[model samples]
Target: MPAEGARAGAATRGTQPAEGGPERPTRRFPRITRDTARPEGGGRAASGAAPAPARQWPLLVVLGTVALGLLLTSLDQFRPGTLLIGVALLAGAGLRWLLPGVGMLAVRSRFTDISTYGVLGLAIVLLAMMAQPNPWLQIPFLKDLLHVTLSNK
Candidate 1:
């Protein structure tokens, strides 16, 4: 059998200090030394030297639309406001897909950002279209499904 020291020495060949050298922390998923590169389509909408807001116009447009939607909702115009909010998110998805320089609007990888924005936008729009007393759209099985799941019996 190998000695305990032999086992440890073999196990830590690359990681161990060279007989009293400085201790090096372990690296995990750290091939790059400084930082990761930005995702595709993640550059500024405008060139540098522009104001920060102008550089990130895509994100701002979506945010401004949503803010307006919220303002309408606060004034008791719920359905149209919600529709506008959903449309803003949908527009964000479109911008992420179509624009090469979306700046901060590109949250993650292209596919992930597109998928997330599309799904959330569609969900919001659908829910808004189906909200309460006299919903604009309906799924016939959803009522039965909800009843079945919620019933104690």
Candidate 2:
């Protein structure tokens, strides 16, 4: 057995640090870097500079519509608010489809974006219709669909 002070370290043949030296800096992921490339022409660049970023007008429009809808709803205007929200969603979908350059709006792929927007808009509209005291857009199938029985009778 070795002495207490004589600890058995790594079996260094020859190349090993004596005792005190500056520790080597280790590299880590998610490095923040600046984007300094400037666009040459007004259009999309071919190579060097980064591609032209997508426009944001479409998303802004959608957001503005939603804001207006929310304000109206807060003012006890249920019908118009619900309709406006549905319109906003639908319009957002149309914008995403027609104007491919909707920066933040283009979250998912083209097919996914359109489908998600369309489905969500339809659901909101349907829910709004059912929310009325005397729902004008009454569908027997939908009423039946909502009636779920969990009891084992």
Candidate 3:
């Protein structure tokens, strides 16, 4: 067995200061010498990061439009007109989903938005019209003209 002092010497031998020379400096994180060691894009290391989620706007819009159409169709009175409006609304929404570049008009322009709303409003008006009985022609000019032309032949 070695003496205590000899054991201490053995432990410090490799780490000792050279005769007539200064001791070397030890590093805490040898892998990261400078801040420049980081890449231009700084964040978590490459080893274990989670991936980003994908966008699904098209799916969302289609589902929403279908729901709206279904609700409109279920309402009492004006079922056919409601169905027509639903069809138009769904067609427009479908176009917007399928063709985003063209849909930009729907998103960005007030005119297009108003026009779409106007079409919906017109559908409602047509529904009202459907509820009322058809009005007979007051003048009956066209029918008379047709009768005269047929009798002359």
> How many residue pairs collide in each prediction?
0, 0, 0
The Cα local distance difference test for each model comes to: 0.88, 0.66, 0.47
* Stretches of candidate 2 exceeding 4 Å from the true structure: 1-55, 145-153
Q: Write the per-residue lDDT of candidate 1 for residues 1-153, one digit (tens) a residue.
A: 567677556445545554556545554444456777788888889999999889999999999999999999999999989989999999999999999889999978999999999999999999999999789999989989999999998
lDDT of 3 by residue, 39-66 (tens): 2222221223333211333334444655
Off by over 4 Å in 1: 1-33, 151-153
Return the clash pairs for model 1, or none.
none
Compared with the true structure, model 1 gives a TM-score of: 0.78
Candidates in descending lDDT order:
1, 2, 3
Index of the highest-lDDT prediction: 1
**Rank order by TM-score, top first?**
1, 2, 3
Q: What's the TM-score of each model vs. the native?
A: 0.78, 0.59, 0.24
Q: Which window of 10 residues has the lowest lDDT sum in candidate 1?
A: 23-32
RMSD of 2: 9.8
